[model samples]
Target: MRSLLLLILVAAIIGGIFFAIPYFRAHPLGQSTNPGATPTINTTATALPATGIGTIKAPDGESIGISDGTVAFATGGPGGSAKMQAADKLKAGDTVSAQSLWHSALTSDSGDAESLIYLEDQHVLNAHVTSNTPYVTIVVATMMTGDNASVGNDNLQGAYVAQKEFNNSSQLAGGTLVRLLVANSGNDKLYADTVAQQIVLLAKADPTFVGVMGWPFSSRAEVAINTLAKAHIPMVSQTASDDALTGASPYFFRVAPANKRQAVLGAKYAEQSLHAKTAVAFVDPSDPYSQSLERYFAQQFTADGNKILATEQYTVGQKGHAALPQLLQNAESKKPDIIYFSGYAADIGVLLSNLPTSGQFATLPILGGDALYELNYPSSARAGFKHLHFTAFAYPDEWDVQNLQSQKPKF
Candidate 1:
């Protein structure tokens, strides 16, 4: 009787642990600060003054409104000002100072409400306004483009729309915005390097450019990040996913999650959830992004006791590679449970068209890296790729909207 009771107790404890694990993983108890979203503002603006600082604390629900030293700040609920209460009494050359949080002057009507008062590196506004239409510059290389039928149009179009919305909205730190200068990289790796170098030089010659927005492919981004680093220009990358690019330089930051991070997660999923017995890796011999991730995935999957049936290489952009037949035959021989491809969507599409319709791979699960997410996947071909899953490290539109909803006014 005691033995049976002990067994029951052990079973109950194991069941409790299994149920609790999911909840703990799903919801973290606390949130950390997003340094990028949070702005630090110190109102103390002086060229060279004794003590070099002055601190001012406004009343609760009131912001330290500083413009040309004439105080005409709106006092209301945290970040509820309908329009800026302009202090026209102050003019250029006059100095204004305050200490408070820097709220999103762009999308948020909560003017400087949630911004923390970090006193370091405070500055006086340039006070020089531009009457000319503001132009936003986008930088990229042709390696970022899509192929026929699914020609990467969706991604490029989405980026263009997002940029237009950002510039036209009331959130602009400067004045009215206008044209978008898209600098193209001619699909050549060498050209990508040159394009990046020219962008920085051009920005220095023109002062109107506020910030840049692209470098779609990770290879192009690898080259561009270094040039933009020296320029000290703020840029937001739309699609670059190389893990090394994160915090690569002071000026480098990505709108998309690092690619390797997503790959690691996929690796874990394959091991723990899918219980994959064997994995076959197919990588583009020419493409750096595909090759790097393929190598990394193979190392990880092998470490997990999952047998790597084979590591095959295919040259990118070359039509009708002889490797497909070998790949199918290998799949039949090894019967790998999982097949991972780190190559362009077009290449994968072609390979899928030629893959053997019988046996092992007919039912084998297919996995891929970020290159698969290119918008060019043919709609008709979507069903053919029923077994395909691609990894992308990015916050979908829903996550951004949730962030907006949860935002609190710092005032």
Candidate 2:
């Protein structure tokens, strides 16, 4: 009887070991069984390069890399993939299909501001291309990601509206059609010069390619402008406002007021409207736009008998972010009457969001140049600063009114 019981126990133990081995193999340790759970990835492994993954053949039989095309430097996420797909469709002469893919990509990326206008322009332009109709291409190059994305979107929309009207007008008299090509210059316009080189290639390959427009950021615009100017391409800036860009190139022209004027206006507003006597200015040293605004603002403020307490410097990336607390602490220590940030909206948004509600900084009015006009902080974040003000290129309603009037020209 003892031997029988021992045999049964041994058999049961062996069976349990077999069952557990298969279970462990199927569901390894430290792995989640939940379907929605994300699997752990080895981030330290050799990762793929963000740009320059694939190549597309241009009209001139030249292979264009991913870094210098429709979605320049935006070659990582779903938006980038979709844009690449659209490029493939465009190359196949299927602009109608490409338009759909572009729309999808834009929607997925929450980039819907220029959607309708972009689609309309693409349809019209692609029709001309497919029919072998004579058309002139104007490339709109700007920062299409990060804080400047809104500005870039506005630029694209404005260009499309102009293109549509020009193409439909009797003034053209059935002349060469105008097509706008969007070239994204990365998050902070880091790839603007590379994109400019690509535009030069396009101009060389296609005789119909005429000009370039929309360099909204100064630092990047300076480099890009030099490249395009050397290539003898006529270029126009929609909203770049740095004084240094005044004679950046013979080919470059801008309709917007320079930073000197904008800073003077900003200084006057701070003194007269905000009742600020002394100020501290925050600037991004790497960005010429920020530097220009800071220099001009300081000069104007001091000229108006107001003192500048200090000027704080910060760049854009990880180092800047890591030092933000210390920078804010230093700025707070200055105890100035007003705080002026002459940086782009992204950094300012971070500064504003992190600013403490109850402190020496509390109830202090913050002023900035037009670069902060696109500050898109959430309502909760915005509520923290009741006196936040920035100079704008123009009022929002005026843009709508002008657009309407342009569409319905009298006489």
Candidate 3:
């Protein structure tokens, strides 16, 4: 109970587009304890299959499940959420949200870990392991350095906890044992590529390797997916929110919704919850995740009858508030009600700390997406920067966790 409580405050906390464009939509986590205060995005939720596995079957023999998702036991029991809505196809602007991948790998077309999940209905874990007990390996790829490392570490802890819990439950269910592989990408783009290459090499070296759990950044996940695709190894990410990745690779899967969906949520939060009419957006064109979000926020906010005064673009490497003078200029000229950011928290934290220096709109509400869930925001930013508000996913309660586990993919 104590550890679970820590997970909630530390790592537990924590999408989609509008209209006839045909976008993917899933049930949003109503995080607030207050029923009325909870944010809602009306999406659909379907029941688990009778097979009692997380893997969803497609027209083909292929199976799939969302991963790199989230879980929180804060409200008693575990609740899990992936970052995406499963769809056969989704189209918005120039983007196409790809259908969930369900390709047969080795013996299983579904890359999901259904056989490995703990089922609520049965009250036990169900799985099919090779005769050689603990034969397959589920590797976790994450950032282990830089400001993002803390988030990655927390996620890694979850993996360890999951490994232990799954193993114990599997034993009771009369299933095979499984092992885990923890890989740190060093948080460098180039180094991440090297790590991805090494991961594939390791997979080749070990016949027992089966699937991967993640590489948190979309950029890194893409790099790893390129290689994993050839080897037919599957990976599920918890936080990589790149929208273009929807159809990018069959070997890659995300438990979280894409960035576009989160962008819509951000816009909704700003408009309906905050009652903001005009806003300035800070975007990074070089980052696919950030770029996709800029478009999503603009589209949804405008459609809702609100205005985005001006969008200030920034590069991925721009440290501190060095690049914000132009943004501040836009904020001043527009006198917007809020400033929207669609990038990582480290950079945004710098901007928030520098807001007073912007000389205008310093106290304006700062709205963002899940990136604002950065654990260090409060300590890293100025005292008044609590104005930081973002649209983040909430973990399911324990009841939801059982339902989610019962439905994840199986071998």
Candidate 4:
């Protein structure tokens, strides 16, 4: 009887301990000891893939499609897709519809720079391509999106005007029509080499492709020029002015003066015109054009018995922007008489826009290279600087008949 009672007591104690374990776990040492409250356990076991997210598609779900005499690679947003549609329409010989789409695309929220190719130019190219009349093609390779799009549009306008004039006149033997093919190289011409390769393929397949024009940036222009030169194609750039591009290729030619000449001209203007003795040079070292201009300008300025108080280098994107405040402080500490910016308008515009109007930089003259010609600063931002000057390859008012006659002999 005693042994059985002891066993029964042990079994009861074990059961009581088991019951108390769950109660302690649920209530812990806190005051909340509700009988119905039980601890909840989440059993979800879904795991994220090791490869992470897949490739992101464009917002508008459009892909770049290249065709003979038509190239559509502008893929940013709605504006890009709309322009692609416009290209399709133009290829189908629907000028009216294509022009309408193109106009709408320019005004869309995608911030596409206005294109200069008009209905007449599109019709001319289309007509020449389909008709049997002998025609020579000139591909205009340029960045049709991002900050440099305006310059690209200007290049297209110039090429179109030339094509129109040539096709209208009896210049070509046997009445050969002039056809223009536009090749968009994307923002800052990041895809310039790839587009150049496509242009080479086009030239190989079609003998009518005679030349190319408008390589706006020197950073990627060297590679593109070399590729085209290897294929025996001639290229002419209206804006690329890096000194390194002087002998990049035998087929490469430029309408703009090299960086060395432009830098010397800028330095002379600063010393003679502005009477500046000390300057602060702000350059984007990542860009070949900016670096070349900065190097040459510094050399010429020092050679002319002037001093560069500080040479601050900054890139062109977010990292560069983040460093601007520090760069400005450093430049201010140097007590420069003038500021020389050897960067594109995208960066210089931001720098000037945010510059305080009452500081030492207010009245300090800011002289920049030809890249500053594209500056589109707001009126409020323009008020921040008293004197802002930039060099230009040409001035419209100076290109009169007399000026042309005087300059013709030199050319």
Q: Could you tell me which 10 consecutive residues in candidate 1 have the lowest summed lDDT?
A: 115-124
Give the Å error, residue 352, model 3. Answer: 2.1
Output the TM-score of candidate 4: 0.73
Task: Please give each candidate's TM-score.
Answer: 0.58, 0.72, 0.62, 0.73
List runs of model 3 lying over 4 Å from the truth. 1-135, 171-173, 317-321, 357-362, 378-382, 395-411
* Error at 316, model 1, angstroms: 2.4
Q: Which runs in model 4 stand beyond 4 Å of their true positions?
A: 1-84, 90-118, 125-131, 188-190, 317-319, 378-380, 399-411
Query: Taking the tens digit of each residue's C-alpha lDDT, what string does model 4 give over 172-194?
Result: 66676666666666553345655
With a 3 Å backbone cut-off (N, CA, C), the pairs that clash in candidate 4 are: none
Candidate 1, pairs of clashing residues: 79-110, 101-115, 101-116, 102-115, 106-171, 113-411, 114-410, 142-185, 150-376
Each candidate's number of clashing pairs is 9, 0, 29, 0
Query: In model 4, what lDDT does residue 185 have?
Result: 60
Residue lDDT tens for model 1, 1-411: 111122222222222322343342343211112213311122222121111111122222122211112222222334323212222212222223222222322145421211111111112122123343433333322232213222223333343333334443523445433233334443344344444544544444444443445555667677666555555554456556766677777556555566666677767777776678788888775666777777677777878777888877776653535566566566657677778877777777766665556755675677887667654455644655867777764324434566764542111
Candidate 2 Cα lDDT to native = 0.62
Best by TM-score: 4
Give all candidates' CA lDDT scores: 0.47, 0.62, 0.53, 0.62
lDDT string for model 2 (80-179, tens) is 6776777677667676777888778777875342344446557565667687656555566665555456566656555554555556662233455555
Query: How many residue pairs of model 4 clash at the backbone?
Result: 0
Query: How many clashes does the backbone of model 3 have?
Result: 29
Ranking by lDDT: 4, 2, 3, 1
Local error of candidate 4 at residue 285 (angstroms): 2.5
Q: How close to the true structure is residue 334 of candidate 4, measured as C-alpha lDDT?
A: 93
Model 3's TM-score against the true structure: 0.62
